[model samples]
Target chain A: MANERMLMKGNEALAEAAVRAGCKCYFGYPITPQTEIAAYMSKRMPKCGGVFLQAESEIAAINMVYGAAATGVRAMTSSSSPGISLKSEGISYAAGCDLPCVVVNVQRGGPGLGGIQPAQSDYYLATKAGGHGDFYIPVYAPCSVQEMADYAVKAFDMADKFRTPVMILSDGLLGQMMEPVVFPEITDNEPEKDWACTGHGNKRRHNIINSLYLKPEELEESNRERFKKYEIEKAELPEVETYLTEDAEIVVTGYGASARIVRSAVNAARAEGIKAGMIRPITLWPFPEKAYAETVETAKAYLVVELSMGQMVDDVRLATSCKRPVRFFGRTGGVIHTPAEILAQIKLIAKEELK
Target chain B: MKRITVIAGHYGSGKSTFAANYAIDMAARGEAVTVVDMDTVNPYYRTADLGDIFEKNGVKLAAPRYAGTNLDVPILDFDIPGLYAEGRNLVIDLGGDDAGAYPLGKFRQFIGLHKNECDILYVVNFCRFLTHNAEEAEEILREIERACGLSATGIVNNSNLGFETDSEIIGSGRLKAEKISALTGLPIFCHTLPDIPSCEGIDREGYYPLTVYIKNVWN
Candidate 1:
């Protein structure tokens, strides 16, 4: 019955998936659009023999995850945009210390607690820059509630695989929307954590979990080793979902919730006899440059859509290396882009290509 | 039918979606209906989110204070006593369980005065957490009743798993709802079905087929 199709909100599905994925510890604070994750964890975690802590604040919550993750336990924390900002320091420490943990940012609008509605403004923060450090977190953008559930499990696996913090970049719309989702089968395939800070009891060499490396040469070595791991991560990850791009003139692209709207618009354009296609990046950090490369010759121009003022647009341009013109259209402050509006942009691009 | 209908349920029980559709259905029947949203606990996907839909359908939506804005603070904006005194058809969409339904206690005196005219309906979804069984459903119903100081007159079997709902889900949920009905001695008002094509074989008796208004754009 657990695998049977059931309707669930994105937040609840993510929490349930985390539990099934062998996540032993969860720490979170209450915030709109993402409070359901904490609420679900409160009820389900204790029943499943997992620890759920509602820390005093967002800063406290992420530090709690850091402590739990150091002991080789699967620990995670979730929050909204403002709360994610508060957790940035802890995330940087996890990246520096090579502590594997999951961080979910079910983003709401923001510059300063902008709105309770959904927005995709945190692309740059999650991918290119997080806290003050030379680090990159694996960022996944899930488009539907089902993917929200699937990616929560994948995030934990990927985090442990690379021994780094993995970020699931969701938005308010995906957080609150309801859809039917089938949960994945539970597996106990976790790798042994010989580097964990578990008590040795005079049996073996004690493990040290730390982020401070004062020696300049030693820190450079640490940074270089981490960059080598990131190179593999970039090569192994970076998933993209493409639609009708073989002979297309204009390709529309977006990530997470905005990509759902872009897919609909691309379909509408195809129906109207325009050679429009879509390329949705499922991984934000890697940017899926290979997918863009495959379309560079066939697709004449690119249209990037988003819920913010075009944060992911910069990635599209860089991925294409300015070989094609990339246009950006977006709605900010929680206003979502309608499919009709995106279709109109595609129409304009199609007509201009005639010249 | 009662003049005032109050819908209460556990979290994610589809109460807001049902209340929104019920208000529109009443408006279609030429009733001057004003649906009041008192869900301050959970911010998103409440009746407040469908303000434009309600406006287009000729239904009045009275959302909470500071709703539809960036502020996360909870405030009851409507004058409940005035709405009760206005003599229009009223549908109050309460928040989940006792926490979200606590605001309804302020209008208890008005509702008690017109007890016969008020129909406090408890919506049930078997798939939701904390209410998967008859005993669990009764406990939540009693909690909501205690929080609002009113007894539920009816039980609405609104059991569906979003867009994946089908006739089999409806049947299984009805069986569970019937057990609760037997234990609590409340009548089953109606079984709600999502307006999907897979429900062709579903029985139409006492069924309320609804066009799901709150949906993802791609769906």
Candidate 2:
């Protein structure tokens, strides 16, 4: 099949990409900002010989995902912030049981059903264990509709490769926005799941999928094994995009939509003779520590921008080990900062640093 | 080409998608096209989201003040009035439902004066809820017209199952469109199909092949 170019919404594209990536089961509940994913799946899944089950709630949806993933079928579930909160317990179980699955959070503002609009306040929740565990799920933040489609497939692949859950952390802007995208040709060469809980035949022993371990030592061993994988992921899976940072005096950093706005801000600042560049972390989990450390060598100061009140700023600080001052600028509760707003912050930083 | 084309329908009727493709089509034919995003009710899918497509195709976009911003406020831009100026081909992508059509009531006087030069199209999709049949579609159409204080000049058959759509589905929609036309006394403006190689077996006039501009992110 040739690559086909089509215009799609971020949420719709994510659903289609999962189907094309051989995802056999989709369990999701409708929520604002992310409802299109469930809607799209409801239409496409059956046609593709896949399961499109809309569970009664987000809690049931994630648990259904767990069941499908335990059977070694590619499975996924998506929700917004409040819905994700409800699914946290199920997500923790999936992580602890070492099941491979993809979870999409088309985030909205929330300390509680804050608003049904774009927000990035789920950074801490997503990067740290969103569920109640010391486990880590590699979170991919996509800036464009194209990347939304790309990352959905990548999340599935990464999840299976590491035998853990992977998250595509998107916001309402990316979830709702549409863009032209070229879909990769579908392939049927997914990795085999040797430990899958298919009925154990005479050739193999039964595979039990459980998060609970009776003994403390056994649970500790499981934690140690997961941490070993996390360390490997930190070394292997960190992804970032840097623009004009070679001789930049000031580097603005952000992820997802904020990164897109920051790129425009950097361009505007450059035209005005301000040496501004950008470092966009594509994978929020690994934090792109090496990229930040390398850019800090040339960049004198950093501006951490987001759609929330400076959640990712902590990671940016730790990435560079506080080598230079990291300033924060953002709006919370569904407020989006414009490129002009970001450029003004960059200009202020340049003035202070150049002096 | 009509001087002003207003595309209106219920939610999920693919009105914004139709307006974007229509504007792009007009621009491709060398017309000076400007698409105004008059959608204030539905925040997610709107013509303003296609700014890049409009820019690339040389079509101007006049959107609401908070069209692409994170704010959920329904503040329309002041430049909206400029879209009604004569000479250029204009496409007005209205919001879904009667509530979405409320803003158009304010422009009723201007539209009424130039009604002959404007085309208010009621786009119908049988696949959508509250419009599964001709009677239901007609009721919603009257509601929208009453809200906007402007009568629909034509009916556009845009019924489909998104990417799952086929020629047979599109052909079946023509019957629903005919019923809507009969009940509303409106002419069939066009029958829309996804832009694919072969829409075989279904021979219908005004077959407008559409390149879907508005889509869910994971299409």
Candidate 3:
């Protein structure tokens, strides 16, 4: 038996989920659309004997998260679009060192000083390697508050499980939206701190955490090992929800908030005699490329829609390998896609799809 | 186009303040000059506080977009597209020590592709470490040269008496310039002028040279 329903905002659920995931260290600053996360952590962390630091800046906050994660403690940070750009360097370092830290981006409009409103413009920065050099970060996108809570817990486990940095690729709407969520119970058994920097208390030797493999061959070997981890990750990580695809000829795909919009369009498209289905990605990084390809094999066409102007579509297209007609419709810089608008495109694509 | 002259010094030195005021003096001279505070290490006295003043002087400012400046956060990507492509000079005020400036390593790949149009200057205070002696100065020059994968062609000798200037900005500066000259064989481009020059401080670095037009100069 489990507690089935509780009202929660997406941001609030993420914060609570991190706690349930055994994350006791939270370092973050207050920013739009995701402020609720920091606020919730501030209140809950204190009572739970956890560490919560409201850092002076987004840069400092991310570093604080880095420092805690370095100690092998479950640590996290949350910010919006502009703030995410500031944290890219740290995120890159985290990947370079293979540290487990959870970073959440309630994306907003961008390029520079993008608005505080909701947008998925950070798709490129998150899914693709945003930082310099070559290392892959596991990115998770949660379209609903329920997934936000579940992913929050899973993000920490995945990070610890894979020894990699994981990002919750969210948007302001998902972050701010309120919905009924049933969170998992806090577990008694925490992961072992075999690799963390927490002092061994006169153990065998001192622990040094660094990404500097000075020797060319040594660094290259380390990079190769990281890629090996990524290869295994790709096999195990696939998150998606499909609807009404038994004989659908066209598919509408999206994630985070846009996925919600695509769901509505999917329902309407079906009513209009358009054989349209919906595909929402739950994990953005270990991107469910297999599911995408499998769905596309029988479908006549695919329609990709997002708030950002065709960023994720690139990944979608690459996954599908141009097997079917893959089209895109998107808005950049703080514009949300509407269900009717997406259905109209779905209708247009289904016309060809039906033929 | 805006102009900026980076003023660098050792840890606990006043170079950042000097760079900040230099931008201020340029603005007073009716020149729009913004101080691009690239100091990633230091927490206080950054060029960020002068954003409004520089803006008023037509001197636009740019710094890491941190809410606070002291944290050791990774430097953000500057998205002012074409700043490096400018035909005018832009000042890149840096933090103390070479390691403080190590972040430019990532951008070196991009900068190298555009080296045909940009200028990079190393600011030195003779009394500081590494630049305090000719041998040390040579080592410092070598580090910046190698780190950026570009030699420091221009030098700014901001030799100061540590808030106790002799009312004359000459002896200390001249010695440092000579050392830089003898060491790198690069020209001592300019030293701090008691009276700052005229130039709006905006535009990204490499656009134009940040110059302090000193009268009665001796070098």
Report RMSD for candidate 3: 20.4
Worst 10 residues of 3 chain A by lDDT: A1-10
TM-scores of all predicted structures: 0.95, 0.71, 0.61
Ten residues in sequence with the least summed lDDT for candidate 2 chain A: A1-10
Better of 1 and 2 by TM-score: 1
For candidate 1 chain A, which ten residues in a row score worst on lDDT? A1-10
The sequence of per-residue lDDT tens digits that candidate 1 reaches over residues A1-355 is 7667767889988999999999999999999879989988988899999999999999999999999999999999999999999999999999999999999999988889688889999988899878988999999999998999999999999999999999999999899887788898867767999999899999999999998988989999999999999999999998889989998889999999998888889889999999999999999987799999899999889999998888988788889888999999999888898999999999999888635
lDDT (Cα, tens digit) per residue for candidate 2, span A181-266: 66666556468998899998777888899988999999999899899999999998999999999888899998998888898889
lDDT of 1 at A181: 83
DockQ of 3: 0.01
Which ranges in model 2 have alpha carbons more than 4 Å from their true place?
A: B1-219
Each candidate's interface RMSD: 1.8, 8.6, 27.5
DockQ, cand. 1: 0.61
Model 2 residue A302 lDDT score: 96
Displacement of the residue B88 alpha carbon in candidate 1, Å: 2.8
